[model samples]
Target: MDRIRIGLVGIGKIARDQHLPALNQGGDFDLAATASRNGRVDGVEAHETVDALIAARPDIAAISLCTPPAGRFEQAMAAIAAGRHVMLEKPPAATVSEAEALAEAARAKGVTLFATWHSREAAEVDAARGWLADKAIRAVRIMWREDIRQWHPGQDWILAPGGFGVFDPGINALSIATRILPDPLVVLSAELAIPENRACPIAATIAMRCGTAPVAVDFDFLQTGDQTWDIEVDTDAGTLYLRNGGSRLELPGAEPMQGPNAEYPRLYARFAELIRNGESDVDLRPLRLVADAFLTGQPTPAPAFEF
Candidate 1:
């Protein structure tokens, strides 16, 4: 199989830390080019804009767009128009409608458009999903807290209007919940703790109606010690837990089982498979829930956060 020539857009921290390393090591992709205003990858052709990348690297078969969700729709449409497959980062677009439109356009253009949920590809997540396939979940609890300064660093866009803030990481939990649950989830209510100085919420307590049961998600960006990303479910059979970002799973009566930390590698492989099979993978349930929270959630003021 010919390796897919990929152009990476938005070469920020994630591109350097996760995407670049995964692409370089994966056998299915070649880092043919990069498009970023200030960031560049060594040994790869760099362009300041996607237009230049499309014109200069005609051999590029696919583009992995890691840009922020705000302007993703236009760039994704551009890629599809150029006859290239697109793999979007999480929260495919700022709005679910935009993601749906992109999917429709991709189908019209007959190109593969992959919306990635990296956390969904974890081995343990797959196992948990299989376990809960037949069981009934009574409730779910999610605690996803991390130090934004440590995770996002100097990225100012995270606090922008389109930026999700705590929901940025919180969406990962929602993605997993939506996938593992047997029934659909709807946002029931939410409390957003906005910093006086920032545009987005710094902490949040979200409630959801997962099927008949209530699911609660607690998210905080100011957590300092032992950054946690954990989810626990109370089911008819027993309790199921995914701690340490879905890398570990615990069941009712069994020993704790650990899974591989290969989310990015598996994600890239899935992208390749979609391109090879001539299909698009676009799931917006997670993003939709976030959008709903914004529409229906009540604002709760918190102390001003200083970066």
Candidate 2:
């Protein structure tokens, strides 16, 4: 009961890059094992699937899902079915319906579940929320531009039918924006620039509203030059800046605040807390916003993209 033995279900890039280090840092958990079809962490017991991992290590108290959203539903349900706690990465699943179903299933099974928005745990993001609490927000602008090839070179699933291309990164911005803003922003109008050869959009422009305030978001997958990940909100007081994917915050009159690059570490800590407390944290507002955008969005055809 002192340390929960957890199994990592996906050993892809994010697992090796972030989760492995965070799990090893001691936060009420012991990295019990790993399951993956393609990759794995060294020195950990590896299995080909969560089912296999469960069969081998029946003592794993929890299962962390680091796989892409497209396959998250089945894997997570399998873990919950086995009466194990579940932790999911951002966006939860490919569709809002699936995410909701998984949450309901976890609740019915009496197991704790977590759908984490890692960016919300950023220290600078916390600062921004504190500052915005006293300010009257008006308008917001978000530019989340990055090179897909550089970030997801061979992840062909990103362009598949249920894949969320630009939204994969843009949802991180939405997570922070929704966390720090004064009110909830709902999607109004959206334009998705879909490639002729792909199923998902490579770029998107969205207009949203929070009461009378207008919010604009631009998500692009072709910014190979200077990658920009910034959010600016113009309030009655002054403009507030949460830049570098919420690692830096700038208020009207305060110094730029920075935090250690430990977004994943903080995510793991929160997951452990929820599991220990016998509670579930499954907030789907960000994913619901994405779903609304898709439902109300108009498609704008772009040049054919092979990759």
Candidate 3:
């Protein structure tokens, strides 16, 4: 099959670090253009806005959006209207309604819409899911903590109302958990630590349930030293550990299974497959869990933070 000419929106760190590399890895996509305010790719056609890119490149049949979730709904809508398949970054939109609207619009336009959870593509994620499919889950714990200065740097949008703050990364854990756990998660309680000067939470402790199993999540954006992105699940058989953002998995009485970071590459592969099959993959379970946390969470004031 011919390569799908694709344009990338948002040339930020994620685009440069992940999307660009995956697109250049000689897969089913051709990097045709990019749209960003200040960032640009080395030889690709660049535009300052998605509208301009859409108008200028009619040959681009797909748009992969890595932009912040705040205003992504309009961009996705425009692309879907133009008959281009759209791939959205995790936490697809600022609100569940926006994400749902995009999905409905894409379906009406008969275009593929992929709301990608890149963490679900981590090396051992699928294996972990397969292994847990039949196990009786007893309990689960998710610890996703990292320094915002080290990862997001001075990106103040994270503290903005729609940026999702800690949930931006916390949702990755939820994505993996939702994928591997057999039952659906229901957020029972959440304690959110909001910076005195910010609109979003800097840390959150969420208590949830998956069937009879209790799930606990600890999310923080101010960790300094060694970062932690780990999930531990206790089952009737034994314990399962997915560490390093799901790239490494450790099972009871067995050696760890680890693999290189291929999340973005695998995500692109799935997008290509969906486009070819005339289907859309817009799993909103993880996002819904985040939304539930926000809805039921009790806010507490924390010290003001700065990067």
* Candidates sorted by TM-score, best first: 3, 1, 2
The collision pairs in model 2 are: none
Best by lDDT: 3
Clashing pairs in 3: none
lDDT of 1 by residue, 191-301 (tens): 999888788899999888878988888999999989998999999999999988888999999999998788888999999999999999999999998998888889877
Compute the lDDT of residue 143 as modeled in candidate 2. Answer: 96
Badly placed stretches (over 4 Å) of model 2 are none
For model 3, residues 94-138, the per-residue Cα lDDT tens digits are 999999999999999999999999999999999999999999999
Candidate 1 ranges beyond 4 A from true positions: none
| Highest TM-score against the true fold, candidate | 3
User: Residue 196: error of model 1 in Å?
Assistant: 1.2
- Cα RMSD of all models vs. native, in order, equals 1.0, 1.1, 0.7
Model 2 local distance difference test score: 0.90
Clashes of each: 0, 0, 0
* Ranking of all candidate structures by their lDDT, best first: 3, 1, 2
